[model samples]
Target: MATGDTMQLVHQALRENSLFARLDAADLERVVQMASVRELAEGEALFHEGDLVEHTHVVADGLLRVYQVGPKGSRQLVLHMAGPPESIGEIAVLSERQHYPVTAEAALPSRVVRVPREGILQLMEERPRFTRALLRSVAERQFELLLLLRRVAFFEVQSRLAQYLLEQHATLGPGFPLPTNPELAALLGTVPEIVSRTLSRFYKQGWIRLEDRRVWLENEVTLIAVAKG
Candidate 1:
């Protein structure tokens, strides 16, 4: 895209995004001046956990997956999936953390606006509405992390998988595009073999139908009951 066209898209995204919706014209223009666009191909790592935090990124398009790798390097736990207009690395910037808490990767081809940490800090200091919005966004992300942690601690893998399937069904509809076994396992905090076994069990139980790797919900009530357990 042309530089002018990209800037126009960025301006529109800032206006529409919850984090930047409160920025006035002057502040938005300042941000536009200070930001640079970054493009990522699928499977590209944006930043790894423990890397020094230097910039905050706002997704312009496509998907970014935030995750943490296990100590033994045998497992990956997905923390979140961020889409257009969503901010990444903001918590590190807000807290002035020296290093990133998790790794971010492009789940698909993506574009993100990279704003220098210093510039973002300056804006936060100057814009009260922006500061408030940033705080709220951070708090909500923390809450979601806490909830996921709780489930991982207390829920069985089967129950968690069921819950995840139900969630995907609700969000993406009956003919939901399914993640690969390994990806699904990462999201559910397990290994692929286990995910495959459990999914087969679900299939036999008539909880879901899988065709061409896409899942169709067969019975939501049973899945909900399992999810609650």
Candidate 2:
């Protein structure tokens, strides 16, 4: 895409984002100028956990996954997918920290817009409104992170899986193809084999119907029980 077109897309994405919700047209234009847009192939690493943070990124198109590597070389999935208009690494920037809390990877061929720390600081100096909006954005990101933490900490694997299913069913409706098993596993911070087995169990129990990559819930209540537990 042309640089101008790319920047317009970036501006549009930021406009829809929670952090930039209050930004006016002029402010968005400034952000667009400062932002860098780049495309990443699936499995490409955006940044690693503990890497010095220099910029924040917003997904302009496609899915971005936040995950980390364990000492044993195992991958621990954190944030599954970030759709358009969503920003990442805002927390690191707000805390004035140099390192990232999680590693970011491309879940698909994706477009992302990056805003440098210096750029943000400049914007803050020029516009107090932008500074307030940035702070609000950071706070919202923290709240979102807390929700994910609660989901991972208190819920069992099966329940978490079920809750995920219920959410998809609600969002995508019946007979829609869900994400691949591997994708689901990454989202849940587990392995694909485990996701397959869970799907099998749910299918056999008549709680859901599985066909290839598509999942249909037979009795959402059964999944709800697990989510509630």
Scanning candidate 2 in windows of ten residues, the lowest lDDT window is: 73-82
- Model 2 TM-score, all chains together: 0.87
Candidate 2: stretches off by over 4 Å: 125-128
Instruction: Score every model by TM-score.
Output: 0.94, 0.87
Worst 10 residues of 1 by lDDT: 12-21
Q: Write the per-residue lDDT of candidate 1 for residues 13-63, one digit (tens) a residue.
A: 677778777888888888888888888999999999999999988898989
Best lDDT among the predictions, by candidate number: 1
The lDDT of each candidate is 0.88, 0.80
lDDT of 2 by residue, 1-229 (tens): 8877987788788888766656777877777788888889998988888899888898989888887666787657666468787888777876756899888888889988898877777777887887887788777766866877887788777887988888888888987677777778767767889988988899899998877778788988778897787
Screening candidate 2 with a backbone cut-off below 3 angstroms (N, C-alpha, C), the clashing residue pairs are 53-98
In model 2, the Cα lDDT at residue 64 comes to 85
